[model samples]
Target: MLPADDREIDLKTLKFVQYYIELGLQAFDDWSNFNVVDQFQTASLRYQLYEIVYSLATYQAVYAPSLRGKVCEAMRNSIEKSLTPKVMGYWKWESLLGKWSLDWDPIKKDNIMVSGYMLKALALYTGNTGDMRYTEPDSLPFQVTKNAVYKHDIHSINKYVLRNWDDSNFCIFPCEPNWNYTACNVIAAAGSVGYDRVFNQRNFERRRERFLKHLKEDMCDESGTLLPIKSTFTGFTIPGILGPVGESVSAVDTAFIDVPTSARVWSVIKHENIELDPKSGNYKLKGLSGADFIDMGSYMPSTGAAFLSFAFLANEYGDYEISENLIKQADEVESPIEELPTGSLRNKGISVWVGGFGLRARLIRFRDWTNTVVNGPPKQCINGPVLDGYDFQNVLVAKAYSPNGEDLELVLYNGRSAGSFSLRLAQLAPNASYKVSNGASFVADQNGTGIISVKLDGRTEVFTEKVQKV
Candidate 1:
């Protein structure tokens, strides 16, 4: 359970998370015209899916343990969409140029940019929920044509990633055929870390030292700054690619695999990119290029996305003052918000990719990225009582968890009109009596299920503890 001081989930944060849930539920079969930006792949469906999966998984693991169903659905959908021909069709062209043949199977080859996110989403869903559905053979089937289908599961996909790493002389595999982005490679390595955690293996640990050594020695410049892209074929770093935008994003991704190094990199980025305002005394972003201001999704210049990414990095590394300041700045400058019916808040000025980052910035606590990656959802959370079947439109679930295996605590808000809403409780002790904070008592059925009605005017806090008979 969260500490008493940390129990309250603000309405803004709740709305942000709800935004992700609503977006995740929608079908992603086609996104060619959604927010197409051909130059930077950040606006692509693959990247959007990655951001959504990451945000939802983090929210479930850290805040709402009972949201496993929705989180799992979102993750599964993202994984399924990622393996589709539409989402991964670029691999055919890249493979033809690099390998002299067409390969529609994105996961089998060196497209870590796509494979890494898929693997991480799988590991997150399985590890956090203790669900093994993805572990079955041929669980993820990619249909390339009427007669061709590429089959893979969690284990096989991870094996491909590890094999790529092992075969790479640079110790860091490529996102494209010959181009390796430090950020993408870090995400791939983080996926491997999640895989080891899920299967209780030391595959990543065995290669940790070597990977870090090469990452630092071969990929970084003399000033210890992480270069953005390195050529896998020629082992040469790309000139002029290293910038504040790349460094900030890479620092956040690196936290999942290497915490100390991420912190050091963030220190440099914070110094270079952030500055203090004399009048407001709040830290603000500086020294950013026009490209940094451009929203990767819509190809339109929007400072909100850049501010959100910077704030996300600051929040990930325990720099709360800077994070808060950056967010405040973003809100002041880019303040157009759209309130959805699902109790979600969306910034109308930013792209979906930037919106996802906004949710991440709001939900993440200090060092949350590393903690959630290394040690997944707590055991008590996995085996504990879960709240379900609540009215999502009317009831905003801020915090829902069982401190032990027998108690439930929740913080909820009225999404629209304040009224009484019914909620179902699962995994309770069968036929046992429980006490609710509202002075109501109930007994669970033989299957350990019960329903409780909560009345809400604004914000309500509720807890249920099992009764111990003398």
Candidate 2:
């Protein structure tokens, strides 16, 4: 372990690191055995397992031991076999029959490359060393970036166009059929699977720079406004950030909405060096493929997504592009939390929060921090984003992330129950009446920040910590 006097972090760092290691182990076993596809060839399980493997490789390289070879190999085989190289990539939802059945969707195909930012390290670990090092387990995802999205010197897909619709700049950028954070996974996985040999550090940095430049030059307005999916006027030739609450919500309306300017704000902030007027909030406001920021309002979840996204970047990259206040506010954010609402069990290290209900809610926190959700919370915390359609399951998992992007607090409650439930505060104001959306009462104690004794809908339980300041 790093010394207690280590200047960079605290025991929390150790805990966080160990937690990730454990999480990786859990995911490894889960993915190795869990069916990749379902009866209808649907992807019952997500691909964050690749992320876990990548992180594990990283942790082992600097802090712990590398994973076993057999496990790594299995992971590698599954991912490589599953991928179908194209202009960019094709999305084939897998099934859960303990087999390689695939549900392929070639349509709506764009070149989005999403992955947890850890892939490069993993690939290097497993790849050519003087001798075969256990650093990379076969579980690493890509054999080569060429195998990832790049083919030789040509980029089959434009990273910018993955989520945007652009047509004019067709040569370098692709349309929104596939590019986005999801696609980042492809790049990250390839890098992790292959390491610096293929996705060289210099090359990876180049990709990030290129992606940013494209978003600024092709997708964003000089006036600082971002489109929803793509510049509406340009179609799929160019790609950039568009406004949004949900992908299902039309980009046109999202840009014009009233609550979540966060998506737009983040786009502006990420490329903050844009030659525009931050104060005027006007420049080439409309010439963006010839439209107007006429639809400037607010987006709730988009704001949340953007803020959380910024925080994620902050946590990962330490690039302070946004406001200090904004970062600090994010650092102090609380879970729209509930103590366990039905069960009497006092679960430690869990707290929950919600931004929206049903399909629109996002669980912001997960063991793999970059394991984000575009629509619903992972079942690890929330129950039934599962589409079962049965109404009466009142209590499920409630998870939330602190603004600091450091603490993950979760809770349990019945969406259907009314009587008060019990729980301990894991992430909240201790010995203090904290503010929650539901205005529920909580008993606070100190676990990490402040553990709470909770009562919601008549059931009861205990939690171990509260929101933390970064």
TM-score per candidate, chains pooled: 0.92, 0.35
Pick by TM-score: which candidate is best?
1
Residue 356 deviation, candidate 2, in Å? 20
- Per-prediction backbone clash count: 0, 98
Q: Residue 54 deviation, candidate 2, in Å? A: 5.4
lDDT of 2 by residue, 159-204 (tens): 2222222332421232222223322322432342233343233343
Estimate, for each residue in 1-470, the C-alpha lDDT of model 1 and write its tens digit: 22221444688888777777666767865553245554226667678777778888888777776545565676678778766766666666667787676566878767788778788888888877777998999998866554457899999989998888899888788777778878888888788899898888988889888889988998888988888888877778767544676677778877765778888878877888888988988777788775777776666778787888888888887788888878877776664667776557877778777777777788787877666677877777677777756766567777777777678888888886889888888777888899899998899888888889889988898898899531
Best by lDDT: 1
Instruction: Give me the displacement of residue 258 in model 1, in angstroms.
Output: 3.0
